[model samples]
Target chain A: MVIEKIKESRFTPDVFDITTFGTAFADHMLLSWYKDGKWSEPIIKPYGKLDFTPAISVGHYGQGIFEGMKAYKGETGDVYLFRPDKNLERLNKSAERLDMPQIPEEIFMDGLKALIDLDRQWVPSTYGMSLYLRPVMFATEEAITARSSNEYLFAILTAVAPNYYNKPLSVKVADRYSRAANGGVGFAKAAGNYAGSFYPTHLAREEGYDQVIWTDDATHTFIEEAGTMNVFVRINDKLITAPTSERILDGVTRRSMIELAKAEGIDVEVRKVTVEEMHTAHKNGQLKEVFGVGTAVVVNNYVAVGYASERLELEDLPETESYGKILKKKLVDLQMGISEDPFGWRLKVEENLVEA
Target chain B: MVIEKIKESRFTPDVFDITTFGTAFADHMLLSWYKDGKWSEPIIKPYGKLDFTPAISVGHYGQGIFEGMKAYKGETGDVYLFRPDKNLERLNKSAERLDMPQIPEEIFMDGLKALIDLDRQWVPSTYGMSLYLRPVMFATEEAITARSSNEYLFAILTAVAPNYYNKPLSVKVADRYSRAANGGVGFAKAAGNYAGSFYPTHLAREEGYDQVIWTDDATHTFIEEAGTMNVFVRINDKLITAPTSERILDGVTRRSMIELAKAEGIDVEVRKVTVEEMHTAHKNGQLKEVFGVGTAVVVNNYVAVGYASERLELEDLPETESYGKILKKKLVDLQMGISEDPFGWRLKVEENLVEA
Candidate 1:
C-alpha cells in the first residue's frame, strides 16, 4: 500500500457541522487505479480534485457504480463497520452491470480498515453521528464511442453524517415515471438509475412529498422500492415487502430488518406488493406503518402515502413500538456495541497499519 | 465571447486517422459554465483536460445530457452543419427531463458555429468522412444530495471520423433486458439511459450481435428502437416504423428519413410495430429491408436479426435501390452542398472568428 500524508488537517470536528449528511470530508481518501488490465496498489492521499479529460467515458456514457456504508465510533473506543463485506459484494454486482472492472476484497476491506484506523479521530463520538463511507468506481478511459472503458478509478471517501431524515416522510406513488424496468440495473447501484429518477422525484416534491414509491416498470401495478431504499409496509400486524428481483435492490439494511423481524416472531412476507393492496389495507384501517430501509437512514418511517388524487395519512410510528423502530434500535445498538452482536454483523477495525 | 488561442495545433488532418473515431480532437473547443442561476459568456479555448472535484454531482448521481451532430466541408470550401438548431432544441428538451437548466439557442448555435469556423481546417473533405461534433452538458456542483445541481458545464468537442460502420450489422431483439421504460428518460438523450444499456448490449455482443433492438417495457410486444438509432422495416412496399413517444427518442435522422419517404411517394406508417408482426412478415417473404437511422451512421442496414433462439438472415441492401440507400445519399448530398437544400436545413459557418 502507498500513503501520502497531509501537512495539516484541513478539518476538525469542532468546526465541521456533524449534522450535515454529505458535505464535510475527512483528511484523506483511499484510491486505486486500474489501467492496462491491471489493478495498482491502493493509496491514501489528501482529498482533492481529480483531473479528467473532457472525453472521459463516465461523464458521457454513465459507466459508474457506487456503494454506501458507515463506520461507527463505539463506546469502547473501537470503530466497527456493519457488513462491509456485503457492500463490497454489491459494488461488484453494480460493476458487472455497467461493464466496469471488479474490485477485489483485499483492496476494499483492507484499505477501508487501514484508512478508518488512521483517521479514527475524525469519527464522531456522538450517539447519532457516524462516519459515512462512500465507495465509488467509474470508467476513466477517454473516448465517446458506445463501449466499455479500458481504464477505471476506484475511491473510498468518508464524511460525518448524523442522520439522513429527521421526521416521518410523505411519499408519492409513482404514476408517470418508472425507476427500473425488468432485466434492468435496478439490482445494482448504477449511477444512471439515480440520474434517471431526479426529474420524477422532483415532481413528487413539488406535490408535497419527500420521495417517490417506485413501481414495477411493466405494469406500474406492483410496488418496487423507494427513492434509494427498500420499502416495507405493515398491515393487519403483518410485515409485507416486495421481494428482491432484477428490478429491485437487495439492500443490506432491508435484509437485516427482515432477520430482526423474524427473530421477534413477527410474520413477514416477501412478495409482490401492489398499490391496490395498499389502498385496500388503508381503507380497512389495517395498514399500520410504512417505512423504508437503507444504509443512509437505517429505518425511515413514512407518515403518508399519496396516489394520484387519493391520500392516506398513516399512523405516527416514531413514538410507538413499530417494527421499524425496533429494527432500527436493534441494528444501531449492535453497531455501536451497546448490545451483543448475535448475527455477527460487526467487523472491528484493526489498528495495525503504519501511520502516514 | 472570450477567446484563448493555442501556440500550435495538437493535431493535423494529414496525421489524424479519421477511421479511429472520437480520439483525435481538433485544435480548439467551445465551453460555457452555469453558476448561481446564470450562464457565463461562451469561451473558445484549446482542447485539453478539465479539472473536476471528486464530489461532482454527475459522477455520483448522473445529471448529464448530450447531443450528437456533424459538420461537413463542402466542395466550395464552406463548412455546413445539418440542422444545428434542431439539435439545440432537442438538447433543451433532454435538459428539462433531467430537471437541468435549458440552454439558450444563442449560446448553442453561435458557439458551435464559432468553434467550427476556428477549426475549419480539421474538417474532412472526403466523401465518406466528416467532422463529428458532440455537445455535452452535465451537473458540476460538488454535492451528493438527490437534488438538481446548481452548477453546470457545457462543452462542444469535435473529432474527425469516417463512417462508423462499413458493413451491414447483425442485431438482436431484446427479450429479457429493456432499454427504456415508459415515462422514463428514454425520450431524452440522458447519460444514464445509455449507462443502463451497456450490460444488455454486452450480452448481445457475446452472442454474435452488434446491437440490440429494444421492446416495450410493459409486455415486450411492441418494438421501440435500436441501440442508438431509430428502426425502420419495409414490408410489401410500405415503410413501417414505431411512433416516437416517451419511450423513444425523436431522432433527427429518423424524422428526415420519414420526410424523404413521403416526398418519394412511399407509404410510410408511423405506428406501433410488434415483434410478432415482423416475424410473420419475414416468414411470408414480405420483409424486404430493415435499417437503422441515426446521425453517426446515416443509414445502417442490418444483415441479420436474432431473437431468443431464432435467427432471421436478411439480404445486404447496399446494392439494391432500397429506401435506406436513397435516403442516405440524398441527406449526404444536401449536407455536402452537392444538391439543393429544399428544406432549408443547412447552416453555414461565418468566417468572422479568428482562425488558428
Candidate 2:
C-alpha cells in the first residue's frame, strides 16, 4: 500500500497523492536569485505563494515567462518527463527575451527532476490524466522604470489534468489582425504575447470558432500557429507546416512531429504556407487533414476553419479526433518507457528517492 | 486630517506601508465585469486577492489591457485629472484589438474619479510626485481554451513617488527590431505590445543606451515612439515625429505635444523620419535634440544615439531638452488649473466628493 508522508517534502516523498493546480506542492522547489550583477546558489523549498508586489515588473508590465510539461504514470508507477530539455531550453529562450537571466540548462532540468521526484505519486493513473508542471519566471523588482528590472523571481507549480482540449477544435484563420511581427516576441512564449491575443481570440470565439490562427503581421498570407498550438497541415501524401520565424512560437511538439514524420519516410515541407494555397487544395480534393500539436494536447485535430466569409468544414478526415489518439498513445508510451525509444527521447523518473 | 478606511482593499494598509514591491494597497478597488456579452455595472469594493488558475486564458493567452494616468494635488489641496478622457478612449481602442467589450468612457472616467475622490489623502504632494493610477483589465475565465475569455476583471490602483527616470538617456534607433507592424495593434497601447519590447529594450540598454526608438516592421525606416514615450526629434529647427501607424501607440502626450508645438509655432512635422536621415543630420549638425514625452517622467531627453555602429552625440542641442522642460512646466500648470486653459484640457474634481 502506498503511504503518504505527514511532514513536508524534505527531500523526496515516500508516497504521493494526486492533486490539481499549485495546491498540491512538492516539499522542494528550485529557486535562485540574481542581484548586484550575479546569480546566487539555488535552493529547494516547499511550494507556496512567494511574496509579490503589484508594482513587480512582471505583475504590471507583463515581464513573465513560463514553461509547461507533464510527468506521466507508467504501469510500474515510474514518473517520467518527456523532452524536459526542450522545455528548459524554451524557458531560457523566453528568459532571454524578457531580459531575465537564464538558469543554466543543467540546473533547470535538475530542478525539475527533483521537484517531480518529490511529487511523483501526484502523477495520475487515469489514461488522459498527468501531473502538469509549470516553471515560471518574472521580474520581482518593485521599480516601475519602464526599463528592464534588476531583480526577478522564478517558480515551479504542478497541476493534475485530464486534457487541455475539450474536444476537436474549430478555429479561424485571422485574415486581418496579426499576433506578432518580424521583430516581435511571438517566437518566445512570453506572458505579453499570450495577453495580446486575448481580445482577438475572444472576437474569434464570438464568431463561433475555437481559436484564431495568427498570421504574419505585414501580410496575413502565411499561416502561423493557433494561439495555443503550432499547426500541422496534412495535404495528400505530404505534411506541410509553416516554418517558424521571430513571429511564431518554437514549439517542442512541432519539432517532435517533424522527427516522427521524417522517421516515417513522409515528406514534410517546412515553408511559408498561404491560406489561399490551402483553400485551393481543399477545392481540388488534395487537403487531407489539419491539426494542432503542443505540450497541452499532443494533437488537437481540426474539423473546420472559418476565413474571409467561408467555413472550410473538413469532412471524411476522421469523424473522431484521430491524430491526437494515435500520437498521444505513442507519446505516452515513449514518455513512460514502455515503447521503442526510437528517438532516444524520455527521461525516466527515479523510482526510489530517499529523503534526507 | 485623513481617516483610514478599514478592510477596504484586498490587502491591509500595512502591506503598502511596508512592502518593497506593489504588494500593498488602499482599501477599496473598482470591479467591472464583462459577462452576458457586455460590461457589467461597476462597483467599488474591498481590494482582495483574485483566485485564478494557471491555465486561465489571461495567464496563458494574455487577454489583458491597461491604462496609466494620474491625479495631481494643487497648491490649494484641490484635485485634478489631466485629460482623462483620452485614457478612456485609448483603453477602448485597446479593448477592440483584444476583442474585449469597451467600458463607456463616462463609466470609466467616473469610476476613476470616484476612486480618487474617495481616497484623496492617498494622493501625495511632493514635487515631481503624484498618485500614479493604473487601470487594468484581464481575462478571468478558468479553462484550457485557446479563444478569449468570456469573463474579465477591470480594476484600478495607485502608486506614489514613481521617479520614472534617473538620468539623461542614450537611445538607439531600432535597427533590427520592430514594436508594431502595419494593420497591427501598435496604436492601441495593448499590454502585449509593451511586453514584446522589454527584451529588445534590455538589449539596447546593455549596449550602453537607455531606450530604443522602434521603427516600422515592414521596413525599419521611419521612427516611431520610444516604446514608452513618443519620440520628438528636432532637426536643426523643426520638430519631427513619425506619423502614427496601426503598430505605433497613439500616445496622449504625443498629441498634446503636437498641439502645444503648434500653439508655440515650433513648425512640427508629423511624418516618417529615417535612421539614415538622422545619421546624415547628426554628421552635419542638423540633429538638435531627441526627447520622449509620456505620463511618467513627463519628459526624458536623450543626449546621444547609436545607429548600427555609428554613435551620434547630440549634447550640442541644449535647446531641445529645454523645450521639454518648458512644455512639462506648462502642462503641469494647466493640469493643476494654475495656468491658462487654452486647450480646455483639465478635468477638475467635483467638490465634497468624499461626502458620498
Candidate 3:
C-alpha cells in the first residue's frame, strides 16, 4: 500500500480570480480504469487533461457521473471532509445507475486526500467558503454504437467557492414538471438528472425564481425535490419531508437534518408530502417553514411558495427554534469539529488530527 | 434571394466517403443565432467543428438537440430531400421543448438545398443506404449554472450509413425503468434522452438483446418507444402504436408510417398499446409484426421480447406484408424519384434533375 503512495509528476499551482469554474487542475488527480471486467488499481497522478478526443462518448452522449462535496478550512486552518463517506456512497450509487464502474472507497478517499494535500493553499479562509471538490466518472470509449462503452475514466477537480448565494432564497411549489420518476435513476446523482432540469430551471429564472421545485411524475401532486435539493416543510411543529423512494434523490443533507431533528427532540416526519396538503396548510396558516437541504447550500431558507396561479407568501415561516438554521449550525459544527461525535459522520484527514 | 443563393461557402464536390458515419462533411453549414430576444440571421458556411470548450454546457450537461434527414441519390441519380419540412417542424418542436431557438423552416430548407447541391455525390448510389444528415444545436456558453446558457451553436453533419444493423435483433420490455414521463422532455429529440437509455440498453445487451421497449413512468403498463426507435405493433391485422405524448418522442419516421398506412388502406391505430395486450396477442397468435421506426434505421424488425426472469419468445409470431417494409420502400422510392409523391415530400437539389 505504501508503494501506492505516489507523487504528482507535475506540481505547479496558480492563483486566479476568474470566478473559477472547472478549469484549474490541481497537482494530482484520482485515476481509475474499468476494462475486461472490473476497476483497475486506482492511481493518483499529475492533474493534466487526459488527451480527450473530440469524439469521446461524453461529447456525443452525456455518459458521465459526478459527486460534489467540500473540504472545509476551519478557523484553526485544519482541513476536514464533511461526510465524505456519504459522497462516496452516492458516487457508487450514481455509477451503478449509469452503468459505470463503482470505485472502491479506500482508493477514492486516498486519492482525494492526496490531491487536497497538493493544493491546500487553494482552500479559501472565508467563513462560508470551502474548496468545492468534484469527482467525475465518464465513458471514455470512442465507439459510435448507442450502448454502454467498455472503457471509463475517473478524476477529481477542486475549486474554491466563496459563497453559494448572498441570502436565503424564495422557492416555488411544483405546479408542473418532474425531475425523475419511479424506477428512474433520480436516487443517483447521474449527469442526466442534472441535465434535464436546465430548461425548466431557465423558465423559473425567467419567472423571477432562482430554482424550481419538482413534483411527482404520476400526478405532479406530491412535492419531491428542488433542482438538486431535498425539500422540507415545517407544518404545525413537525419537520416534514417526502420519504426517499425511487423518485426522490436520497439527499445527504436531508438525512443529516432528520438525524439532527430527532436528536434535538424536534418532531420529524419522513413521509409522502402532497402539494394539496401544503396548500391547505398555507390556507390554515400552519405552514411555518419550507426550505431545501443539499451539500452545496446546506439548508437554504425559503420565504415564498408558488402554487397554481398565485404565490403564497411564507414570510413568517421560521419557527422560534428554526429547524433549518439549527440543522445548518449543527451540521457545520460537526464539519468544523466543534461538536462531539454522535453519528460518527465526519472523517478527519490524517494531518488534521493532533498527535497524542 | 439570388444573392442569398450565390453566398457560396459550401464544401468542395469530392471530399466524401462511400461508407462512413459522420466522417463526411457537407460543403456548407447553416447557422442561426438567438440573441437579445430572437433568432438572428441565417448564414451558410464551410462545414467545420464550431469552436467550443471542454466545459461548455452541451459537453458537460448534454444540452443538445438534433434532427436526422436524408438526401437520396435517385434511381436516375437525381438528388432530393424526403420531407425536409417534417424535419424542420420536428426540429422546431424539439427546440421549443428544450427552450432552444427555432430554426425557421425557410432557412432550414434553404440550408439543406445549399448543402445538397454542394455535396450531391455523397448521397449514396446504393439501395439500402442513404446520406444520413444530422442537424444539431448545443449550448456554447461557458457558464456552469444549471439554467439555459445564453449562447448556442447549430450545425448539420452528413454521413453515409450502409446498414442500420448487422442483423435483426431482440428487444426487452423494460421491467425496471421508464425512459421519460408525462410533462417530461421525452417528446423532444433532446440529447439527454439518449444518455438515459445507455444503461438500460447495456443491460439488454447483457441479456442477449439489442434494445429496451420503454414503458410509462407510473406503471410499466403501456408500451412506449424502443428508447430510440418508435415501436409499431401489428396486432390482429392492425398496425397499433402508443399515441404520441410528452412521454413518447414524436418520431418523423413514425408519423410518416401512420400517414402511409392510411394511403395503403392498412388498419393503423395510434393509441395506447399495453404490454399485457401484446403478450395476450402473442399467446392467442394475433401479434403479427413488431418493428421500430427512426431516421437511423428506417424500419428495424424485432422478433422477441424479454422481461424479468422470463423471455417471451415471439419467434412463433405471425408475419405480414410489413407496413414497416412498405413505408420504408415508399419513402426510399419517393426520395429516389422512382415513384411519384403526391405529398411533395421530396425536394430536388441537383441542377441536373431535368437531365436525369
What is residue A18's positional error in candidate 2, in angstroms?
13
Better of 1 and 3 by TM-score: 1
Compose the digit string of candidate 3's lDDT tens values, residues B1-356.
12132345343444343343544454445666556656566665555444443345554556667777777787787887777777888888877767667776666776567666666766776676677777777665654444566676665556555566655669999888878866677888776677778778888888999889999878888899996699998887799988899888888788888888889898999899899888888889887778898877788778787766666665433234666677778777766788888877777785631121
The best candidate by lDDT is 1
Q: What would the per-residue lDDT of candidate 2 be over residues A1-356, giving only the tens digit for each residue?
A: 11233364432332234232333444445666667766666555655345433344554566667886888887877777888888888889877876778877655776677667766766776565677787777665655445667886655566555567667888899887777877877788787776667666777788999788888877788899986799988778678888888888898888888887777576889988899888888889877788888887778888898878898988645433344345556666676667877887778877544364
Regions of candidate 3 where Cα sits further than 4 Å from its true position:
A1-56, A104-107, A140-145, A150-153, A316-320, A349-356, B1-54, B104-118, B307-320, B351-356
The better-scoring model by lDDT among 1 and 2 is: 1
- Please give the DockQ score of every candidate, comma-separated: 0.71, 0.35, 0.30
**DockQ agreement of candidate 2 with the native complex:** 0.35
Over B1-356, each residue of candidate 2 has an lDDT whose tens digit, in order, gives 12234443343333324323233355566767777787777776555455543334454556567777878877788888888988988888888887777877756887788878876776655455566777887666654334557787777766653456667788888888878765567887665676678778878878988888888887887778888888888887788888877877788888888888888777899998887888888889778778888887577778888788877887733444566666777777776667778897877777654444
Deviation of model 3 at B156, angstroms: 2.2
For model 1, residues A285-337, the per-residue Cα lDDT tens digits are: 99999999999877888989998878899987655478888888888888887
In each prediction, how many residue pairs overlap at the backbone (N, C-alpha, C within less than 3 A)?
0, 16, 2
TM-score of 3: 0.86
Give the best candidate by DockQ.
Answer: 1
TM-score of each: 0.97, 0.85, 0.86
